[model samples]
Target: MTVRIVVDRDKCQGYGQCVFEADDLFGLDESDTCVAAAEVGEDRRADAERAADVCPMQAITVE
Candidate 1:
């Protein structure tokens, strides 16, 4: 199984919170924008959820 990930660039503030929570699934580009894994193994679902929870801008979504 895999979890889908989406980061709303318009709403993202480049805070890196999501990256901190899930380094393997999230990252920041040179401009500090949120970059994310399009999909990840189900084993990483909890990490993805945590990243979503910590997103101050509420720009991260996991499904």
Candidate 2:
């Protein structure tokens, strides 16, 4: 199954915790806002989940 990483832009505060956890999948934009890859493979499932868990605002979801 294809893994997807979802971030709630309205709820995210751009804390960078997700970026620190999964640099390959998450990042800070020019405005320092949270940005994430649209999709990931199974191999990155754990990392995606970890990123979601580390989001202080609970704005990230991996599925």
Best-matching candidate per lDDT: 1
In angstroms, the error of model 2 at 28 is 1.0
| Candidate 2: residue pairs that collide | none
| Model 1: lDDT of residue 55 | 96
Could you give candidate 1's per-residue lDDT for residues 43-62 as a string of tens digits?
99999999999999999989
- Tens-digit per-residue lDDT, 1-63, candidate 2: 779888888888989999999898999888778889988898999999998998999999888
Could you tell me how far off, in angstroms, the CA of residue 31 lies in candidate 2 after the best superposition?
Answer: 2.0
Q: How high is the CA lDDT of each candidate model?
A: 0.92, 0.90
RMSD for all candidates, in order, please: 0.7, 0.8
Candidate 1, residue 47: how far the Cα is off, in Å = 0.3
Please list the residue runs of candidate 2 whose C-alpha ends up more than 4 Å from where it truly belongs after superposition.
Answer: none
